[model samples]
Target: MGAQGCREDGRPETVLEGWFVLLLDLEAFAPRERVDAFHHAMTDSSVPNEIVHEECDAGMSARIEGWRVGALDLFDMRCSGLEVRRTARHVRQHRDRPVVSVSLQTQGIHRAEQAGTRSTLGPEDICVFHELAPRTYGWSGHGASQAVTVDMEHLGLPVDTVVRASGRLRASPVHDLLLGHLRSLFRDPGRLEADPGAGALANATTDLVRALLTSAAHDERDGRVREAMGSSLVPRIMAYARRHLTDPDLGPERIAAEHAVSKRQLYVVLGRAGIRLEQWLIGERLEAACRLLVSPHHAALPVSAVAARCGFSSPSHFTRRFRAAYGTTPSEWRRHRIRSIC
Candidate 1:
C-alpha cells in the first residue's frame, strides 16, 4: 500500500515521516485490568504477544496516567509495543531497533535492567530503556500502572547522542514533558490541528527527545554545565518570542533587553546554534498565524486579522512571507487545511 493509505481503524497505514503521535487512555481499568487491556491491544494490533503466565508475579503497583509525544519517521519501519508484567523475566532476543519506554505508576514499584545496570522506578517516577538490547523488567501489582514505547527512530534522536546523554537508563524532566504532551495529544487530536502553536509543539517534542538523549550520553559534570548555561536558555527565548509574536516591536533588541542579555550575546547564542535569530522569530510568528488561519475558533476572523495577530503589519508582506515559509499563500493554506480536517 502507498504510505498515505488509511486503515479501517482510522489510523493511517503509514503516517508522514516527520512526526506522528498516539494517545491511549486507561483510567477505566485498574492495574491488572490495564495490563490485560494492553495485552489485548498488542495482540489485536499484530504485535508479538507471547504471554508467559509463569513470569507473572506480584511486584510493585501504582496508578498510571499521562501522554507520550515524539517525532516519527514512518519509513523507518521500527516497531514498538507497551506491556506490563509483575515479575522481571530474562529475554534472550529483543527488537533490533533501539527502544525507549517511559512509564508512570500510581501505586507500585517497577525495576528495569539493561547492560548489567538496574534501576527501580517509583510512583510518578519514570524509566527509559533501549529495547533492541537485552533487558529485564519486574513490577508488583501494588496498584495500577501505565507505559508507552518509543522506537529510537521515531524519537528523532541520535542513538549515540541519547546514549551519551542518558545511557541505558536515566530520568529527567523531559520525560515528564513527553508524557504530558502525549497524553494531551491522545485526549484531543483536534487540538493539535487547531492549536496556534502546533508547529512549536511538534518541535518541542523532538527537541526534548534530543536533549534527553544528549544528556544521557554525556558525563554528569558536562551535562550539568550544559543544562545550567546552555540548555535552559533556548526554551526561555522561545517562550518569550511566542508570547509576543503579534507585537511589531518584538525584535532582537527588545528580546535581549527582556532577558537582560546584550544583543550581541543573544545573537552569539543563537548563532552558535546555527540559527538566525530574526529568521527564527519570523518563522515562529508565521506558524502561529497559520494555526489561527485554520483554526475553527478563529476561522471567522479575516485573513488580515490572523496576520496581525502574528505580528504581520502589511497584508502583502504577510502573504509573501507566509508563502515563502509554507509554500502556500495564507488563504490557500487555510482552505486546504480546512478541507483536510473535514
Candidate 2:
C-alpha cells in the first residue's frame, strides 16, 4: 500500500482503497532541513503552503497523519511556531482544484488570514480556509491541529456563503458534534481502517460538516462577528477609513457622506460591530502612527511628522493616546522594536 500524504507525482490518487494512516515526520532533521522538508511535503500533497519561521534559529517539528476518505482528506497535525502562506503562485501551480481546509485548533492560538481578512482561532475553535485562495496562517510558539480537506465543488456547497463565513466558527452544539466526528475518524485511523463501514463513515462525516456550515451561515445572516468584520461591505468601510485616516476631518459625518449613508445608519452598523465610529477612527490613526514610528520605511519620519500624518492635531495628545493604548511612548516602542530586530 502507498503512503497517505505522499503523492507519486504531486497529486493524491486513490491507491489505498480503505482508510489508512500516512505519517510524515520531521523530528530527526535540523531546523532548516525540517522547514524545507515540510514545504515539499505540503506541495506534493497539493496543499500549496509557504512557511516562514518568526525565529529562523528555532528548531521545528511536525507530524502529520492523514486519512484518505473518498475525495476528502482528514488529517491530524502538530507543528512548531511558523507562519504559513498559500500564495497565488502556488495556487496557479496547483491548478487542478481548490481545496477546502477546515481545521480545529487543538493547542494554541491559530491566526489565519485570507486575502486581507484575518481571524484568530483559539483552542477548540474550528476555522476553515480555502487552499487555492491566497492565505497566511500562523500559530503562537507551538501548536497542534486536526483538519479535513475536501474539494469545494465535491460537496456542492454554496461558494459565496461559505466564503464569507470562513475562519469564524465558534463553539456550538453542531460544531461540537462535527469536532467529535472528526476526532473519532482521524485520531484512530487503524480502527476505522478495519471497519467495513469506512465509506459510510466518510459520507456521514461530510454530511455533518455540511450541517455545521449551514448553522454557521444561518447565525452569520443575523450579523455575527464574521459578518461585521469580514462581510462584503466591511472591506469598503475599512478601505475608506484607512485612506482618510490622516485627515483630521475624518469622522462619522465624513464616512457617512463618502459611503452615501446617513450618519445614523452608519452608527447603527458600526455599533452592531461593538465599535463607535469616533473611537474606531481615533484607534486607527493611533495604530497607523505607531506602524510608521516602528517601520523602516518611515524610520526617518520624525514623531511629530508621524502624528501629523496620522491625523493628530497635537503631538502631546497623540503621545498621551499612544501611551494609554500601548503603555509606552512612540519613541520608546520604536527604539525597543529596532533593538530587538537588530
Candidate 3:
C-alpha cells in the first residue's frame, strides 16, 4: 500500500477484515515540515482542493484518522485554526466522482458555507456539504469534528435535492436518528467494521441518507407553499376565530395550534396587517353582543345572556366594555334601540 492506503507519517495503515484506515498525525514531523505534509495528506485522501493557513508556528498541529467501509468513508479531524475551500475549479475536477458529507461539530465552532447558505454550528450540531458544489468550511481556535462522506450515487438522490437538503436537515424526521447513528458509528468504528454485518450496515446508512434528503425536499416544498399562502393566512385565522367566537377557551394559543403555526407567528402575520389580535377579538365580541341585544328574535334574552352568547365570561366585564364602546350601559342601549324602532 503506497501513500493511498498507508499513512503519510510512515505508520502502517490499520486494515480490518472489511475496512481501509488512513491515519496522519503531523506531530511527528518537524514544525517546518508539518504544513506541507498536511496539505499533501488532505489532497491525497479524498479530493483535490486548497488548504490555507493564516499563520503557522510551533502551535500548529493537525491529525486525521479515517476508516473506509464499502462506499462510506468516516473521518475524524482535529486541527488548529485553518480554512479549506473547494472552489468551482475543484468541483469541475471532481465532477465525475460526486460525494455528500455530513459533519457533526464536536468541539469549538465550525463555520460552513455552500449553495448561498452559511451556518455556524456548535457542538452536536450537524451540517451537510457535497463535493459536487463549491463550499468553504473552517474554524477559528481549536476545532474538531467527525464526518461521514458517501457517494451521491449510493444515496440515490438528485444533486439539486442534496444541495437544498444541506441547509434544511432538521426538517427531516430522521435527522436526530441519523445523528445518533453517526455518533455511535464514530464512537467505535473499529468494532463496527469488524462485524459480519458491516456491509448491511453500510446499506442501511445509505438508505437513511436517501430518506433524509427526500423528506427534507418535501418539507421545503411544503414550506414554500405556506409562505406563498401568507396573504390568505390572516384572513383564514380571522374567519376561524369568528366561527369559534362562543368558545370560552379561544385565544392566541388555541388559534395558532388550529392553524399549525406558533403564537408568535400568528401575531407577526396579524401585526403586519395592522391587526391586534386581542383588540380585534374584543371588538368582534362586542359587535356580536350589540346585534343580539337589538334583535327581536333575542328580545326575551337578558343582557347577561347576550354577553354569555358573545363569549364574555363576566357580565360586569361586558357591561364595562359596552359602556365604553357605546357611551351607555347594555340595558340603556337596548331600550334606546327599542324606542327608535317603535
Candidate 4:
C-alpha cells in the first residue's frame, strides 16, 4: 500500500511505522485568546502569517500544537489558511542558519516554492523548504491540512543524501517514508509520550529523518542509518549506568555482569564511541552531583551530603572532579545557578 493510504490506527502497515508520537494538548491553552496568542507566537518565531476568516469554516475549528520529538524537532501542524511569505525580510530574520522545513499535506492543497522549484501538494503530498532561503506557501480549500516540519538542528544526519534518496517530488520513496511517519505520528498522538517504546521509536525517527535530509542535501549515501542502529546500544548502557550511578560497585565489572558481557567487551563497546568506562562513570557521577547541588530540596544539605548521594565517596575527590568539569566548586556553582534563577 502507498504511504498516504496507511492509517494511524494501524489498519494498513508501512515500513516507517515507529517514527513519531503526536502530542495534542488542547487544555494547555484553554482560553480562545490564549490559543490565538500561541498561534501568533509560532508565526513570529518561524514564519509570517496572514490568517483570513471564511464563512465556509471558522478560521481554525480546533487549535493544535504538534510536536515531533526525536533527536531533532518534527512539527505536525493542522490549521486553516496558513499562508507564509518568505521574502528577503524572512532570510534576514534568520540570518545565515541552514534550516529545512518539510511539510506533508494530509488534507488541504498547498502551493510551495523554494529555490525556483514549485510544487503543489494535495492530500498525502509533501513539500520541503529551506528556512534560510526564500520560499512562499499558500493553502486553500475547505478542509485543513496536516504537515510535519523538521528543523535543521535536530537533523544531525546529513541532508544532501536524504534528498537524493527520497527524490525531489511526489513520486519519491524518501518522501513516502516521511509522509508515512507523519501520518503515524498524527494518528497516535498519545503513544509518543506514554509508550514504553517511545525512546527507541524517537531514536529511529531521528535516524530516518537524518538519513532523508542528508540524502536530500548531498547526492551521496552514507552509512549513517546503519551506524545509528548499531550505536543504539549506547542508550541502554547509559540508562544502566544512570540507574546504578550511586552504587560503589557500579563499575565496568558490574556493568558487564548485568549485561551478560565481559568487562573487556563492555570497554570495547564504549571505546568505539570514544568514551572510556571510568571517564563515563565519572561524568555520570558529576552530572548527578550537579543535579543534587542545584535542587532546592537539597540546598541546605552539605557538600558531603550531595557528593555521597551522587556516589562520590570522598568529598575532596568529588570537589576536585566537580571543579575540573564545571570550572567551579559544586557549592559555588549551585549557589550561582540558584541565585541567577531567583
Candidate that scores best on lDDT: 3
Clashes of each: 34, 0, 0, 22
**To one decimal, what is the Cα RMSD in angstroms of model 1 from the true structure?**
10.0
RMSD of 4: 15.7
RMSD of each: 10.0, 17.4, 21.8, 15.7
Across 1-342, the per-residue lDDT of candidate 3 in tens digits comes to 323233666433444333445466676667776677777777667788888775745478777778766567889998988889999998888856678998889988888888888898886577888788888999988789899888887766677878888888788755765677677678668666677857766766666666666667665356543342343466456656776787767899999998689999999989987889988898979988987999999999999899889998889989999988889999999999999999
TM-score of 2: 0.54
Scanning candidate 1 in windows of ten residues, the lowest lDDT window is 72-81
* Candidate 4 C-alpha error for residue 198, in Å: 2.8
- Across 191-211, the per-residue lDDT of candidate 4 in tens digits comes to 455567565666655555554
TM-score of each: 0.44, 0.54, 0.59, 0.46
Question: Residue 256's C-alpha lDDT in candidate 4?
Answer: 80
lDDT of 4 at 45: 43
Candidate 2 Cα errors over 4 Å, as ranges: 1-23, 30-32, 56-58, 171-173, 218-342
Better of 3 and 4 by lDDT: 3
The whole-model C-alpha lDDT of candidate 4 against the native structure comes to 0.59
Ranking 1 against 3 by lDDT, winner = 3
